[model samples]
Target: MTQPSEGPAATGVPTCYRHPDRETWIRCQRCDKPICPDCMRDAAVGFQCPDCVREASKGSRQNRALYGGERSADPRLTSYVLIGINALVWLAIAATGGTKSRLADLLALRANGLCSPGDGYLYDIERRVCESTGSTFLPAVDDGAWWQLVTSVFTHVEIWHVAMNMFALFIFGPALEGIIGRARFLAVYLVSGLASSVLVLFLSSQYGSTVGASGALFGLLGALLVAARKARLNSQWLMQNLAIGVVITVVGWRMISWQGHLGGFLGGVVAAALIAYAPKEHRPLVQWGGLALVTLVLLGLTALRVSTLA
Candidate 1:
């Protein structure tokens, strides 16, 4: 029997390798079985069987079942509350301090805001740069405060600044948390937030400040993008909504760092993708593939930045 192309071929007698009589219509790349499109899964750039997808989808539930700890916030409960706190912090800051720059300012940034020029010379202002050391790095032209990396995500400059961001996080956090578990979720959250800051830091080490949790939140969204695919859920709706958000953010807004958003998101998605979602007989090279790519990006960014300064 012939099979339809697993990917996209006009007309072919797709044959099922498993059942020779059955047309290998849709090929599952993982198991190499010919399944209908319904049973086909797009994963890591190839098609996988339904069983593979189901197994991948089970990681989150399995982890949750095995270990349930901490009464800290239900993750769901804290989702909205966390968002509220971020917004409130931003509002309080703005109300009292007036408009500030991005959240990175406290961590170790010294920029005025959102890649704002005139903050200071890149290396010239060590104090302005966000540092990995210390509690929150205060944005100064001389040296960056470090604690701010963690704290930056929580503070905002205005009321609406973090409000919408928190809303997005509140909505997406639970689904992501369910997939990765609290520990993994928080890890992604913090790590991605810092990753975003690192991206911003690479961009301009001057007096620019960053605020809001959108970068970290975007990381969750990024993870969900892959999770949705792995779980065999319809991603069209999500893809479109997120696309709109990207347009609004990248194309239509100022004071927004698409780099941070993209970097953090890539970090989170890659982090989630690192371990395996689908059942595999061996550790996937694709796991290392993402790491290599991110490392290259980070290294390239760091180099470009240094060269520019020099």
Candidate 2:
């Protein structure tokens, strides 16, 4: 049998390279392959095929945030998640019991054991002394409730307390996430909270309990200040916020854990500095190493406090 003639119309009308059944006169500007509308991607000069678009993307450097983190598609997502967690914990505490909730008792950070004197009041005392007096002893961080260090960050009892913290997180969380990206933002938050707990462990009453996200929020404030300074951006708004925080901490010193706030702020400053000033040649290594070092230092402080309390 004679073979078909090889010419312009040798294969009949051209079809899409991806979908051979569909006939198309359009072709990719880059690869010159026949492409249908479905397979066509907008290019600088003309339409390009999906394969060419993907291949071009592979060779291009990824866009990163100001602090050398992957740009988040939705910077607000992490904040939303954190808010939801806090809300859920608060609801759980409320359902169990408001300020006197057992859940709150379990979650709040206390450096040492507490004893109930049968009058709905807690007093700091040794477990043996409490037991000898037929009083109820509540375990604390020194008593092996170590999880409180982190849990207290998410636990809150008073309506105003949780509302204020969540509001702060809502205001500042997304902006920080957008600047540093999700992972680094979360790192700053948790590390700041932990530092706050560490300070409470040492500076606050061993018998007194502490809980709330203020430490982490204070941390975000500090991080924002450092980040703005490093990026050479205007930071008047940040300074105002910091001023407000300082006023609140000072005014509420009797009722609030000022030590926690101080610890968190310092932690955030150090964390953001590490992230923003990391060497570009080895940015990830240096940034992560610095954060890890800070965490270890906080943990070491916590251990030392625990030893002293023990």
Candidate 3:
């Protein structure tokens, strides 16, 4: 006659807690419960049960970037900041009034003079009136108001315009920022914006003034294309959407600044190239230097354009 021991028997092997039918000599290091091969998971020191592994996973730390590009604590910060700036500017514009307001005149980008109302009969700053009828008319770039090139990137004409551009930025900004990081993303944006404005100044007709973040938005699109390619991501959808945008722009080329879009796209491609190709060890320095070189080239082009006006 055999007597059942109160504790586990010392003769027979222990069965898995999960699987009573299977016998195993293994035990969970943390819980000391018998675990079979099916229930076993190798740990740093010893085997752990599925439940214990799951619990440990909860306690363990895992760091991942927002868009799966880099390890960042805050991935959406830059995108939200940009959106906030644009929204605040739009709100300020709404509070002051539309084109008629003096604030709008000051903030808006004019292709003429930089002064207040009635600066010139041909060009009025307050009114934003530019008369291309006379030879005395000079582009705003030649007026020593180079700040317009930068300011104009943030300005928008209509509500729909700002809304559309901001919506695009909202969708694309975070992902791009996560992949390229805040600094490089910002450089791509600003450099592309400046390039678009410069193109408008040089290539487009100077009869009217241009304003909007479309240039920068276009830059983001171009940069995304390049960055996605570098990361081996699927960009077919992006390419399709971009093709549609191009079609729309071409359809409304008369009303929209296609030149700005073209320039921004090109600039973004160049900036993304620099950022993507830089040496990993000196990425920050190389990226910054590349941005600076791009800026210098743009500035030189602007100088050449201004010289023509002079």
Candidate 4:
């Protein structure tokens, strides 16, 4: 018995939209376009051509999973906003001549110091040039500079410091935002930053102020580790980079604040744990509760430190 030939020319049937040389009886469910086996994609209802499938995907809603969530918001929106804020702050500082600028004095994080312009630290008031040690001589609790705990996260004394910290944030922020969503990620970043400042207030004896987003960026890394673990995702590379960062931080402890890094890392871990391990049924409430608890702890620490100063 002779088998019937399936060639397009032999059958004289409709050719595929993508490949005129191939004939197919199957058509896309949406567009009704003839498509070859290679162009066919399995859809919920029926087979679809590559073009129809792509178009459908663009219109379809994404589903939530066990690891992350529905991701209804733009994943990178938070990261871009954060980067923009940091960049704007850095540019403003640069325009004002950095440490000597009045803006810097107002924005920079001083744990327990209170120095202003013309207090002998502002050697060049007109040019906004001040001594690097200007922050060391200021009064702390006596002057009511408690807001430094929060403001410090946005302040950076020099170009290099801001650049380095922002670079780290740029690298890690988007990935984290994708994993935990905007609100949770923002909460982790801010709380960790505050935690870092609080640690500085307690641990450092010098009156010098510390500023930068290093603590917050480190907190993101810590959160990444925890979330990846909860999702059973491979985090070996993150671990390696974290170890390297720790070593670099230790070697440069003179220039960097170890206390800030430690506090931020711990805070990120705790915050992420609360978010990642939350029961699916009451995740939002549990996450909010965790955030509240963390905030209370940080506030308690800050109050305790201020009292000591008093």
The reply for model 2, stretches above 4 Å from the true place, is 1-9, 12-16, 19-48, 55-62, 123-125, 128-134
The regions of model 3 sitting more than 4 angstroms off are: 1-70, 114-139
lDDT score of residue 104 within candidate 4: 69
Please, what are the lDDT tens digits per residue for candidate 1 over residues 1-310?
Answer: 3344445333566654443334455677677677764556788867898787877765544434112322233667546666767766666665554554333244333333222343543333232343432223334322224455457667666557666777788778877776555655666676677677667766644445666687788787777777777667787866876787688787745678776787678777776666435234443454445445665565565445445443
Give a tens-digit lDDT track for model 4, residues 1-310. Answer: 2234454543568877877777778899998999878788999888999887777666454544233444536777787788788788888888988766667666666655544456554221211132354443343432576676777788876778878887788788888888887778898999899888888878875467688888888899999999899889999989997998899899999988999999899889999999899987888888888889999989888787777765
26: Cα error in model 2, Å: 11
For each candidate, give its TM-score against the true structure. Answer: 0.57, 0.85, 0.70, 0.72
Better of 1 and 2 by TM-score: 2
Candidate 3 lDDT, 36-65, residue by residue in tens: 787889999989999999887653445322
Residue 40 error, candidate 1, Å: 43
209-309 per-residue lDDT for model 2 (tens digits): 99999999999999999999999999999999999999999999999999999999998998999999998999999999999999999888888999998
**In angstroms, what RMSD does candidate 3 have relative to the true structure?**
9.2
Give Cα distance to truth, residue 182, candidate 2, Å. 1.0
Q: List the residue pairs that clash in candidate 4.
A: 112-140, 113-138, 114-138, 114-139
* Ordering by TM-score: 2, 4, 3, 1
* Candidate that would win on TM-score: 2
Please give the RMSD of candidate 1 to the true structure: 16.4
Give the TM-score (vs. native) of candidate 2. 0.85
TM-score of 4: 0.72
